[model samples]
Target: MSASGLPMRLRVPSDARFRPILLTMARRVAESVGFSAADAAAVGQELAARTDAVTRKAPLAETTPIDVTFDVANTNGAVFRVRARCGGSDLEVTRPLPLA
Candidate 1:
């Protein structure tokens, strides 16, 4: 809590070093969408695996640094936004995420 006694919230900027944390968040989202734990785990596994494959197969210079954001709200459905800025241009994309 802050000095005012309100709950504190934390923010994490999406970066290469935070991939593992993002993977966990994705898994939790999957589970909340009515997927069984096992299924959610599988999805998370595949997400990580695919990310690894891309990193290994692509040249570093050809890849762009991307950011991920998880926006959770009571009145609005969750939103997972991924943005990549590279090649002298900024690309922003947003996806709707559901919580069961």
Candidate 2:
């Protein structure tokens, strides 16, 4: 939820790829909020620990494509914005060569 009280959503085709991008952005945001890299990592580590428990379960078989969106707010507590969705089949994948 944002400062104004709106739900944030974010989607990814798979949790594996989504985590890195999210973590990077979060680290940056934490730094902006006066957190050092070590601090950010510590926070991130805790979050990852919790998330790991949830994601360890199987993926949603029905949805190979994932969509994620978020309601983001600035540090000033004003100007709430929604970030673009960042997931789904948009990720590039190389086709395997056929066996001879």
Candidate 3:
């Protein structure tokens, strides 16, 4: 669980092949917030796209451990945020722009 107790986390080796697992995790998180199955899946794909892009370019990623954290918020209605972290770097995706 995450700080808000409504999060799911996956820790895996920093390898491209494991990206799918992370994406699956994201999809489930999105659906938890009421996204339709297809929309939730799209969110997962987007999360994977951004995460893969970041991890591929991260320094020493091939050897670093990565942690993907998924969270859903209900404060102002449903919102989702996912973070893929390696060492001190963070790659994050969130629904509903903070300023929107």
Reference-based TM-score of each model: 0.46, 0.45, 0.74
Separate clash counts for every candidate: 0, 5, 0
| TM-score-best of 1 and 2 | 1
For model 2, residues 3-100, the per-residue Cα lDDT tens digits are: 44364555544356566655565444444444567865554554444443434554444334344333334455333232332222222111111122
For 17-89, candidate 3 gives per-residue lDDT tens digits of: 7777877877776776667788778888987787667665655556577788877666676567787787677
**Model 3 Cα RMSD, 1 decimal:** 4.3
What clash pairs does model 1 have?
Answer: none
On a 0 to 100 scale, what is the lDDT of residue 82 in model 3?
80
* Model 2 deviation from native, Cα RMSD in Å: 15.2
> How far off is residue 12 in model 1, in Å?
8.8
Ranked candidates, highest lDDT first: 3, 1, 2
lDDT for model 2 = 0.42
Clashing pairs in 3: none
**What overall lDDT goes with each candidate model?**
0.46, 0.42, 0.72
